[model samples]
Target: MVAFTNFAIAALAGYAAAHPGEKHDAHKMKRELVARDNAAQLGARSLASCSNSASSQALKARSIKRRANAVKNIRQKRGIKAPARKDKRTLEDLQKWEAVNHNMSGTYNYDMFTSIEEVFSGNTSCILAPEITNGPYYVVGEKMRSNVKEALYCDGIDLFLEVQYIDTNTCEPIPAVAVDIWNCNATGTYSGIATEGNYATGGYNSTYLRGIQLTDGDGVVSFETIFPGHYGGRAVHTHLLSHNNAQVMPNGTISVWNSPVSHIGQLFWPEDLRAEVEATYPYNTNTVALTTNDEDMWSILSADASFDPIPQWVYLGDDISDGLFAWIQIGINGSADYTEDEYYGVAAYLDAEGGHSTGYTIGGGGNGTGNGTTPSGTPSGSLSSALPSSSSA
Candidate 1:
């Protein structure tokens, strides 16, 4: 529903935004991830892939050992020197440091890097991050809001998703890179999809559990959602779309796509967690035949396979009811041209828009009311402007 005032505004007058960068650290971080995390993080796992024989498997084992040793030697050589430290550095610089450590917020163990390699793990050209299809449920004109739960919602375990956008080339965080996320409700029904089978909102137009935010100073964004329900055909997952740049406009929005790097991906939950969430209220109500993680229909989740999209392992609290956190770093090709996938929003707000920025008051410009933990580093604000910047872990 467009407000009358929304129609009156003429093209978001004088609104332009520029993202900060820390491209300098890219080369070193890139080298370290390739030489170290690839072999150690992925090791050897049973994969459903077709390109292996006993001879190839043995050779691969030797290759991994050689790479692992190379990484060990490199680390031993560098151990005499203190780790690189940044002081009074830009937010982008801080993000680069955390990203290189494989810890988005410096809170998690170094395994974050190990988890990242799983996505890029294997003997294939995963140079471009895998792109998943945008299902029919996606709707344009969704409010640029944060709290995605609607009044009419199902019972499900609470899910809090935190994402960091890294520059694939530098393996560094990309401050202000953009991402949008949407997922089904507790009963496996999307908020905006058409009424076909059991989805309640299929006939009604709604935007629950759907929102977009740009990465903050740490190349991070956060969303509060539910552990999604598994639909009949797909695994229990949340959908995410990413871009290198984005801008909001009064008449419309504009997106800058790094097609060679533009990404449409899904994030899945751990099977154990899924079983617990499903046992809860509305999830158990879902009537569709459940597809456990063991099912191989929607891309296998094993680590050793070539890069197709896969679910991320998350960091969470003691109980399933407590919120959960997940992180994934996208590997991208910077020099490659943006082609193939069309930009998500309308294009052409291109660099011609002045770099000078202007801010508008939404809900009368009151500061956000949530605790100081959102991505924007500020307290929560009106639904349209509450994704406050924050650190990642």
Candidate 2:
């Protein structure tokens, strides 16, 4: 018994030495294990076909009209002349566009929508693949609002993102479903988490570039923010989580833990678009190596014959720098029961003051650690209040 106790003590001490300042929480460890299992089983649940129904087409038509009218109003206010219609594009044109390489050395001049007819005739189908993981930085209980930019004068081209949620079971729009999105700034650092790595700067008290919005009657939610910057080893993308029947707490944050996670996926950008955006101002300052769509494994899997995960986007003006308006229809399984702990791949949780470690150790993948500094302040009504009493790091 004495020998065994000594051996155990030595092993515990070695583990402590290996991971400094990281507490081991059974709850968080279990959550991570469950999330991995979900990833292996999630592919079976993904909807393989992105074909649209008549009802879905009608819903998309209304959404297109709404966006067109909004764009028209903006054009009128800017006093910009309408763009001239180009030659009719064939399947060969689409093939060439999708095959655009990142190493090209010329200015890109592709515009998806220049006229109302072109906008109406665009594809409205959306992929329902749950193949992409929620990534490590997905935090629960984000503030409920539309604009996630947090009014910061951040660098990068302005991006207007619109997402429409559709129920795969009924092929109809899903209203009132909550959608959460978060991404890095122009410098490739995410908000609300600090770590011992270079991936994310420690900003636990900050909530920039993160927010949640409920889908409107048309099952649409929009966010006004900057184009996300690229991080090393991963292509430029935005993380998204969907909650169905989740109640917004009095503090204006959703209870992601208790609510069912209807969908967990990442939205991707085209290689050409990413290259163009990264070549411009502050984005060019990010020294991390860019990962093109062809090189990233996840980006490859996100594409198939029946579905394409890339969002349909068009410039808000004559050029890419003028800003962009992008939209994507996401089909989700309404009955797929998943909570934050199951499929979220959560690495950290943001407390009322800043962010707190979940005691889940991020591997050498260098996503980010949960060692965020706790800012001293009076805890206000935020996502922390929505957490259960048992939820503590």
Candidate 3:
């Protein structure tokens, strides 16, 4: 018995020396085994008392998973300071952006829009794409051509404009819609006109950045154009007018700006994108002062707001130099069942259309309403009221 005691004491000392942090010694373990266990039976109570129990780890794991599930449930239901899905996504948010897939640095995306808890109070709705004054730059009865890249001195940035039209009430894609789009060249000059800021194009009258196209079966009108230069008062934007049931003329001309319009609005470049375009080429050399969206008093997406029906823009391309595809969702009130090549008027009939005749050929007075800056080097808050012309195309 004395030898056994001495042996036990020596083992305990060795264990202490090896494991300073361990509170349990060999004697304590032996005592526990002898005091509690019946060699034939192990009780559940004894297992529960163990320090490194599997049950304890499992309990902690379950608790963490439960908390995670609770958080996910709250988010799904939008019960917290999260905006309901209905608040942000209307029936028209089905327009999937298909483009070159540019990396959007500091840009807006669908994820960010839906994640925000508060619905933006501003006028970004599919119900109504805002319409502003056609501005002073619209060329009355401009040619319905695609290649508007005429200005040689213009430092050009390629732009692919995509617009998706949706039925306002049904939120369905409205097919066979005709759209007319126009903007200025890099030097703040417009095509098919002879005016101020147009001196770079020499003495000849020209039209550089203006064209028209009809929507495909998906209710989309895609344009191949260049990034417009900012001029006197307005920020960078594209003006568009849409006509449902509008006819596509044989020569590729669609006369619909004078027709009963289904939708009219503008597409905007993100302010950051603007800074980039302005830094290069003709944009950098433009004499017109730069303008911003806030300064332009252009709050509404207005008019050609496409299928998704908001100011959100998707720029597709790996690099800005390779050009980018920009998209907008527009809403229009029309019939889904209504299928016909809609005619605004015969294009041939408007062959003689010219002279201050009002269609969308605005600008000459430069009243602060444009996709560019005003001539006076000051921000003009908004476009001037479109003066009504008695003449028709």
The best candidate by lDDT is: 2
Question: Each candidate: RMSD to true structure?
Answer: 19.8, 10.1, 30.0
| lDDT, model 3, position 11 | 47
**TM agreement with the true structure for every prediction:** 0.51, 0.71, 0.52
Stretches of candidate 1 exceeding 4 Å from the true structure:
1-129, 198-204, 250-261, 301-317, 334-393
Q: Which residue runs of candidate 3 sit more than 4 Å off their true CA positions?
A: 1-128, 145-147, 151-154, 195-205, 300-318, 335-393
lDDT of 1 by residue, 272-369 (tens): 55766888887888788776543322222112223323333333333445444444444443232322422111100112221111111111111232
lDDT of 3 by residue, 1-393 (tens): 012245444444443321111122456534432322231022222222331355434433433343234334433443234222221122232222211112222232223443222222111133333233344334424456655555464358876555666554544456777666777777776554444444425322344566666677656666768887766556677767665666655655564432445654556555556777788876888877676544332322121222122343333333456454444555455642211212111111123322221212232222322222222332232112111111221
Poorest 10 consecutive residues by lDDT, candidate 1: 14-23
| Shift in Å, residue 36, candidate 3 | 82
| lDDT at 187, model 1 | 83
Tell how far residue 55 is off in model 2, in angstroms. Answer: 3.4
2 or 3: which has the higher TM-score? 2
Tens-digit per-residue lDDT, 270-338, candidate 2: 665777788899998888767665444344335443345667666656556767677778766677655
C-alpha-based local distance difference test score of model 2: 0.57
Q: What order do candidates take by lDDT, descending? A: 2, 3, 1
Q: Rank the candidates by TM-score, best first.
A: 2, 3, 1
**Evaluated with TM-score, which candidate comes out highest?**
2
